[model samples]
Target: MRPDNEVLIVGAGFGGIGAAIEFASLGIDDVAIVEREDDLGGTWHVNHYPGLAVDIASVTYSYSFEPNPFWSRLFAPGPELKRYAEHVAEKYDLTRRMEFGTSVTGARWDDESGLWTVSTADGATRTCRYLVTATGFLSQPSTPDFPGMDTFTGTVLHTAAWDDSVDLTGRRVAVIGTGATAVQLIPEAAEVAAELTVFQRTPIWVVPKIDFPIPRAVQRLFARIPATQRAVRLVNTSLLEMLMVFGVLHFRQARLGNKAGALLARAHLRAQVSDADLRRRLTPHYDLGCKRPTFSNSYFRAYTRPNVTLETDGIGRIEPDAVVTGDGRRIEIDTLVLATGFDLWDTNFPAFEIVGRDQLSLGAWWRESRFQAYQGITMPRYPNLLSLNSPYSYSGLSYFTTIEGQMRHIGRLFGELRRRGASTFEVTGEANDAFLDEVTDHLADSVFYLGNCAGSHSYYFNHQGEAALLRPNATLTTLRAMDTFPLDDYRFH
Candidate 1:
């Protein structure tokens, strides 16, 4: 394939789709979206496991510009989300500009040509003036390297990359880990599996999902009156923000901070499960907000089922068709499901190499110092390169809002470049360093640091025990910061 577009976007997730729409709205037609999967909806297309759904309510989860008043439920399922993504792509005519089953292996910046050279896994090469990486944080699945995993005769799968062909009906199933994915899938699997065993390394704080279907009449009302829907969205967003603030600022204020959340979660557990020991096992030991809190009405209830078993004894290793526990106990199973989550902070990519200015690799740069970007979009050395939902860009609020913010930021930068007639625009070293310092200082006062909570090995925190996954503020703060591109903060040439 030849170089065919001015801008190349990798991954067809929310960020990529948002970028494409934003650019298209700005009358930039020479854009190409390359997706590794055969279809759109990057993570939604792949993760088709049982009970897969968005944790956030559908109203805020969707695109703000293109509101879906017809959402089936408060928290939409994966299939519905995938269909919504496809709908957006078709509605905005993005499908024609997208190349399916095209995986970008590496992207290198050519200084002389002032363009990006992108290489695919199939040895096909293409070039573009700008490269936007939207390879979402959860795009990669982290399958634990269990001993004798390959030797297992039974089917093995990861929740993120679930195999639909493998039937769980009447089959003995063993699920590893009790993270978000496992919490959702375990309930569904327990209903079908003849015998189900969940091996939980640590307990997770569970809250009621409070999900319900949006009636057709309500959908019609929202469609007829958009302001009403916006009002509802604002209300929900405000409530969540207040909760986050309370959890962060007053964490140690006795019954006001994490204690309140813990009490609510304990009450929820009591209401859901009848067994006393099971309820105790389900209660979390750590601070409620230290890790991502799981929202589920059925997860704890699933353990009350006759066939389902919750094993708190940590796994020692995998022995063929059984999971050996640390306490000399083993649970035999015919299928193993690993819900170990993704390696979000592990920026290692051996197969792909990105050579920035002065032959500096992005991996090497991030390793030397943590990943730093101006507005989480542009790095100092990588000119004309933008990363959507990059490090320190995630939010407790919906990710769609963050993607929109980044897209706007990129659009403003492109506008600035076009108006100034600048061929290449790169963030200055001084500006990047100053921004990093500001972000670091802000993070120090945030909940990730001030909360009376000891950290664990979560995707939210990197190896350095710093919360690199999420931005420590509301969506409005991020949008205001990136609403304009400060040309003075960057170098032109």
Candidate 2:
């Protein structure tokens, strides 16, 4: 682990593997890709809950550069997605260059040597010229400080850390949170558990999912004629872009699109739930697209089941054998399932010291200025360190779109390093300021700020109450910019 390398990639998910492949393509041979898990796949490797599936369509969510011609469905399950990651790893010969079961504890830049001192938990350290963090936004699981959680005698589990061995059959299961994961799991939980109680803090808009298996013949055709698969991907991407235009770009269209979407959701809810009281309880008061909209057909139908119970009073406290709601009802349960979301905006990321120029830790910098980066890639003071999917770097439906932009951006930086015969480069403060200012200018047009999601507790907004997670730009716009973006905005030394 003390071996020095030219580049170090942390987290072997979509971002990390993609970075390694891009770097190698650019003749950057000396690279090391590390994963904390015993295997790769990051989130896909970790979250193994029941009824898990991708919300976004499979074609768009996957890598654009390396297309999977034979996806089982339009939206593949978690294991299939993980298999795709593994497929990419093997295809690109990335497995040979990866260090599994290794966690990066800290990264310190040595100004004199122009190398990043990357420290691992195993008391090992390596100094490399370039550092790339592909540690995903949804990497860390968020479990709230539920009162008396430790005292609970029965099995308690986060959806991210699902225990398959736990006997959900005939057990009274209390599921906490009603976000995307909750919606997906509730259907499955209701089928197995004797009594299923889903605790809802706030209702999220759930719409009908458009999903069906890709026929084996079609898969064969895609495998044989690559153009056919490309056409399918193009159509999927185009459709998603249209949604982006209506929901994320234009104000008037966004408003209309949201209204139509809400109407559709209401119809779907009404169709599924027979009980008027239950339907009313399930209906969301907030505007559509406030939280990340879920795509599920089975979720609403689960509420119609006799075993299922939807609790909207909110949780007051958690006792040893029961959960007390805000309405003072102590619902007894043998098992607890936390479909709680990830720690994206409020996470203590890296959870280790990252010292850059002037001994400035990234933790301290973020504390001062909430997660600002030059095009969400490079920071002002952190030289030769690139974040693959930082704040203000979002694009279309899936993260693969961001990875496509980042790959191009990373290539450009490396190109500059080779062309100018420079050792390192850091983003200029002026450039960082200008980039974010543009983001602010365009923020007013998007649904995040214009319509309603800002008031909602969506992870799209940060702890400072600013919509800092997503960049207000089209996917193509971001991708084209990354192709030959101004390298002069960085100080090459």
Candidate 3:
């Protein structure tokens, strides 16, 4: 297959957009972007449910290169975030290279020609010298296969694919699952619905969030002098990075911080709920770092209202118009909401076939061997393909750091590639093995493995009981690796 473009990015999310903009700045303009959705923003455009907002501080969540000085709130909502993403797409002229509604179906690398032949769902084909897959792990919406999900027929809604058309003002609402998404949407659901019932599999640790509106004066100052916003981003990022290092990666140093955070959580719970049993039901049983902690000031307080009910008994089955608990108790409902998150493994790289050397599918390689990559970018036997947001690549706190760090690394790598006039390069098997070994060896000291993930229901560990999702490195350490790591570890030809 002949090469049609220099680079092809498989998503239009933050990572993809960041890649496009960075490549453009590096004078690589022969790029093409393919998105499956009609719009540009990836998850932000799809998830428009009630009370949808970022949990991370807005100051550090945005692009480091293009910080928005006029964020209305410290925790920006879904609409504003979608707008910000669209604004970046327009600002960088990224839409000119975008092919929306075109989902990539398959990609095959031709070792002889040194190009990737990518096919789409629309029966079209294009080839590129490099393929950058930025498809996020959480892009797919997962619907729990209840015994009678097709039987109820009520207005069923997944938080990822929320339907605002159904009026919840006077309807009985029942929400299932109490993960991060459920915590964010539960408070708002209790407000508008006539009655709200939340089904929880397990209690999660929560801390009070200090979200507020950014005053106009501060916005004016940020716009007038961008240095102020940069400083804020830097300070908050440094503090939050500790959550990754001391909190999750190295649990030994997390003793003091965990005690302080737990004290605050206990105080918040005590102050919010009056009933002792209810407080006990709401309180988490595991350590803070066992699972992904959430930040919400109102989740605990929402149950204090008269219209809300918390159900802890496990689910048995679903009837035509109600849910049956394990003890044979039936709870009637007008709507069923599923806050169940996406299948992290199924949608890891989208439903596509990627054939590498020896006609081996990337999916089969992982299923047969293990989930790994060289610094979460390149893998052995897959030449000229970069998988961003793969296992052991997340920044732990701020995704912006992950995005910026990865984009800079990829840009620098290709810069070196073009300068040397190399047709292709692949990570050495020894290098890939050593890198993954280092990550797994460090897991002994991390909270995910050492402290335990039993009943945590976290996506951090795979089915093999291996903690392979998050990187155990500090933020600055990852930045240094991305910036100055030796290219000799890879085979450039």
Alpha-carbon RMSD of each model: 2.2, 1.8, 1.4
Better of 1 and 3 by lDDT: 3
- TM-score, per-candidate, Cα-based: 0.95, 0.97, 0.97
Best by TM-score: 3
lDDT for 62 (candidate 3): 90
Using lDDT, give the best candidate's number: 3
Off by over 4 Å in 3: 349-351
User: Which residue segments of model 1 deviate by more than 4 Å?
Assistant: 1-3, 249-255, 274-276, 347-352, 452-455
Considering TM-score, which of the candidate structures 1 and 2 is the better prediction for this target?
Answer: 2
**lDDT of model number 1:** 0.81
lDDT of 1 by residue, 223-340 (tens): 9999988888888777776666566433444335567788899999999888898888877766677677879999988998999999987777787788888787978899998988
Off by over 4 Å in 2: 1-3, 348-351
Residue range with the least summed lDDT across 10 consecutive positions in model 1:
248-257
Worst lDDT window (10 residues) for model 2?
A: 345-354
**List of clashing residue pairs for candidate 2:** none
- Give lDDT tens digits, candidate 2, residues 107-132: 99987788899999999998889999
Worst 10 residues of 3 by lDDT: 343-352
The whole-model lDDT of each prediction reads 0.81, 0.85, 0.86
